[model samples]
Target: MTSRNTRHHTVLAAAIATATAAALMGTALTASAAPRPTAGSGRPAAAPVALSAAARTGLLRTARAGLARTAEDIGLGAKEKLVVKDVVKDADGTVHTRYERTYEGLPVLGGDLVVHTSESGRTEGVTRASKATLKLATLTPRIAATTAQKQALGLAKDKGSAKATTDRAPRKVVWAAGGKPVLAYETVIGGFQDDGTPSRLHVVTDAATGKKLFQYQSIETGVGNTLYSGKVDLATAHSGSSYTLTDDTRGGHKTYDLDHKQDGTGTLFSQDNDTWGDGKTTNAATAGADAAYGAQATWDFYKDTFGRSGIKNDGKAAYSRVHYGNAYVNAFWDDSCFCMTYGDGTNDSDPLTSLDVAGHEMSHGVTSNTAGLEYSGESGGLNEATSDIMGTGVEFAANNSADPGDYLIGEKIDINGDGKPLRYMDKPSKDGGSADYWTSSVGGEDVHYSSGVANHFFYLLAEGSGAKTIGGVDYDSPTKDGSTVTGIGRAKALQIWYKALTSYFTSTTDYADARKGTLSAATDLYGADSAEYKAVEAAWTGVDVH
Candidate 1:
């Protein structure tokens, strides 16, 4: 999902003006021979009408229609809209576009769209809209470079990363979670942080299967490396336990232990990054809380929707590592560990660790183990959209008051540095340069923003009719045919997309592949002639993908 696309965001105004002139006139006109039309001109002899609120909205709708290739391609849900403004011509008299919108408390930087023209007034050659969010500053190097000071503070990448070597020594007796006899490996990780903190650990293994059953990392709490120090007591009745040791002056020494008891369900391991304002308790607490919510959402989306257990379909226990790589701005899943990681922001610790962000990262693991979608071109876009679709479903499944279900991504994380949602499903271009539907050129942009086409398709498939409000948000979507649209709801749309991701999609998939996949998935869920199928087709058609 991190793969880069080549679609640059810079837009030339002269090109757009030429395109507008071509679209307005019946024939091509040389720049030297044609008289320039003024902005806001409704006639062919005049420049294209100055972009108004209505016109901007219309342009987004048109883009959706042009790019969409299936029912799943026009699925922009309500509660989101693309707002474009601040259009200016460069010294070369070429037009470059920018947009402004607020999310949470920050402003989002949108991409640029360039316009090119043919001789006829008929519009042609509108090309190259670039992504704007790249403007966000890079993550802080200090946080990424510094290691956790103590064994308690550090959550190793995995037990394997911290495994001790058997120097042909005799086997050592290790105690299991129940304090029973077992074989174990013991070791110490020195130079834990720049300040010379150390990590002590013991890992127990299943002699028969060679599988790791338990890992214990010590917790140390102190003041400037001279205070309270001790091993954290993490009592585990079942599989294992984890603890984060902190040096708190107010409380002296503290350890937060996560243990597995004879309980109904165990903890989930998944990491999602976020840059918040705090480096200690508050931020850590939020990561813990988000992890819990994310696990629940993932389980619900799969179980309630598809009747599947955790990622492995065998109820495999997963782990999550938070505060990875200092001020890390993005979250991702590592296949080797089958876990997720999160990071804090550079400017204000605005952690990218939102609910959707968590789901998105974890879904990447799912995709990797399943479709193994190559993160480039059409397959790449599908991969990104798959994360988004499921991620959105996870948000809606939670149905929380703080973060209501919507089609928007990063609405809570403030990833834009300005408080604005990262992308709009109804119109991906609101973030500037994002194609609302499938485009041959889609494979040419950044995966983060290029994902807009598929995101829009999902929105359209779920909510066919435009200009309606759902789940407490307003969306004024327009259909390609100017017909009313209807949605099959986010829940159903996710079911279809997941089924497609795991069972239908391949490395070369594009918009057409997505269309067939969803239709088949819908037929499997609802009858072939069911309203769901009808809605899917209608939604696709609304975006000009029938």
Candidate 2:
């Protein structure tokens, strides 16, 4: 989810054919150099596991009991009481219960953790984002709410437009960073930025000293395009006299028009007829049509490819809002509303409503429900990359000629006004800002640019290292280690990545953890010594993640 424009242009000359042949030869040589093992190459297929009735009841009872025993069960201090936030029982009979910590009736900000238990109530493991103990000197804040609010507003003004407004009151909470916990006030400020970008800033300030603790923007921006998807059939609900943009096939997913407004659910799109759009932005229904079609395709892709029911796997669809803000240049998926919002690009003629963009934004919801990756640092990079990878997978799965699948992200949007993509998976550094490979300092880079490491790894794992044509798009990938990689094909590659994301990844997983997670996933799906597993290892090594 990178909206930053790129100035570099990719030159795809006819000489790529020769490079493609050489790359293929290198891959062949690499494969010949190390023959694959066959003994542990495949696993016996097993049926999906299910939780027993007694296990479900036990988990429910544990959840309803305030989860107070979790502290002792998971080896926490007596002062730490975990409140259950969510309880998810996996198909393998593993119960994962998420919790938030409160110390002496005060909430701990970074004290959230997930406890994994077996069906027999045996503790398996725990995943915690912070290792620091929740101990604070005082519960009362020295700073007044009014002063905190003013400080937050001033900070927002410094980073945003002059017209930005702050209307919400500050909230008191514990600020936890670097293993230290202190009383703090959380302030939220929202409005349009000076550059016309939307802002949803969350600022934290120390309540005792009035020092700024941290700040993060809630608005996640990325790039898209309407403006064309060819003539296609749409799923609409027919009322007495008109058709509504609701798809019954996909849990009644609907598309709405925000009419340049920023908040609340907009109006449902309806018309007397089913036909929509003329491949132009002049018609309002045109953007809605593209949105509806994109949602349908994304829904079908997830269900057909991964057997996932919906974003939460709850057999429910998330709605979409189009034409958000005036000349808005981005789109985002907000979990608070459980919906996706699109904006009209510069001048209102370029709406950010495309198939892959839809998939990308929706995948964020999927990631939230699954791994719950924290949106910062290396984990944040992984979060963004997961969307890009899965979104690209959806595009290929759709196989639509109007928007053929490619590794190039936001290619149709012209977000940079140069007709180049926002990112290039084969060689991410081509975007100028993105990293070509992983490094020790990668976590310090912007999540969008740090995401390039994983994107490059996925490209190598799926298509190998060299020049290749996929979905009518040419890609020339190079390895950081100058080693040739033999791909396991996109299908198998996507399978491994999905398995890792849903089953193994956690909120604080880094690049090294990701390598282990993907390898373990490949082993589970393929085998411990399978070619796919070896390829996963090689691909990570190619990205300098080892």
Candidate 3:
């Protein structure tokens, strides 16, 4: 995540996302898959458990067929229509289908929901982003759409945005997160930030009152490179005797050189040889190699650890852009481009393309596609924390000897010349700006700081409190309530968090909701009375989220 700017992304329906949402039914629906060795993890992927094309299609059909009844059960009006966003299935035959709602053909912000059902299609529960009843007195706006766009651009310029403007006009949407649903305008502005980072700010304005509802940067911070990871194997493509950074095996993911510019995809890296770098940053291929490795590792981590094929689970690869802006100290993930961009760090010597950084940024795409967490407040904090948690999981799963997995973010990137990490998961408060526990005002803090709560909980649950050494990294995580807690393995904790994120989380899920969702996920994976379930409860309490 951009610790400075934040890890927030906008919701843009890419070609693949649109196709999957409206994909037609297929045949032989089942949960069987051919075993494939994971290049990132070196283990057989969890493909057998992941939903196959047939399975996804069948579930989508079932969900679409029952959409009307599901809306009625959830107390929605006749004008509301459900569009399937994603489908997750467990080995026990439980299904969780996520859907985006529309009111009279206008997209509804914070109208996302997840429907849970049993193997026999019996309703289990439903998670809604907004509990407010849907009823719009009128659809016509009092103000002009051009006015909304102008206001949004003005707001962006006020925030130090250069060349602030939008190519398309503001689109009508229903805002229903914190209060009653109302007609609103969503304006997306493109430009450059004060730091020369690419700008993609989203502004939501109330149509009737001409009041701004919300504004956020869609360029979520994220990276890779020979700068950190030592010599590593990369899935490169060969064309006409030249090897390119394009990886065909893993969703055709490619790495490009931005050539120190702020925008646009630069040149693709190609060489006569596949071996990339000599463990240094001077060679341009060094960062390219790292980015390729990071992408492969992250892809492998998700596919091997959770059976997720890709960020969207559509067997598609998101590309990478490096060498962005001279001395650009930050890296980010842009959902609009479906790519991760890295900047050459201080003096162009330190590239921010560390393994964990890449995992962290790409995980933002995962959150954007799944939970669709808004990039502000408590939900925003969880969004950031989700990246840290999963990014750490990616680092560990990589088992890279050059850069051992640690419970720290951006450690090797050396954003600060003194060799300090961007954030600490074991003791997030160590960073001074981050909160180690939950509080009423936690939601008011910057997402990067408030994220300390969930990050601490994961640390306590996985490694427990007090002194410990893992992968040559020393950690002394503490509990908020001064209570001694027992440790659950990282595998179990990661699984629980992933399940909660996919099956239970919504756009507006706060820390309190997070506690309940994780508990429910644990109950589904393990028994309600199992030790793992109890540990999840204890971990939440230790973080003061109870």
- Winning model by TM-score: 3
For candidate 3, the TM-score is: 0.91
TM-score of 2: 0.84
Ten-residue stretch with the least lDDT total in model 1 = 11-20
User: What shift in Å separates residue 154 of candidate 2 from its native position after superposition?
Assistant: 1.5
Across 1-546, the per-residue lDDT of candidate 3 in tens digits comes to 444323231211111111111011111112211222232433212212577767777878888888888777766788998988888887766678899999999988877888877678777677877767789999999999988998999998998888886945799998876477899998888888777777877888899988988777777555223768777778887878898898898889999998888877899998888788777888888988888888999999999899888888878999998898898777888888889888887798888888988898899899989987776777778888898899899999999888888899878876656667878999998876889999988888777888899999999888888889988789998887898878788988898899888877787888888888787777666657767778999889989988
Reference-based lDDT, each prediction: 0.43, 0.71, 0.78
After the best TM-score superposition of candidate 1, give how far the Cα of residue 33 lies from its true spot, in angstroms: 60
How many steric clashes between backbone atoms does each model show? 78, 0, 3
Report the lDDT of model 2 for residue 401: 82
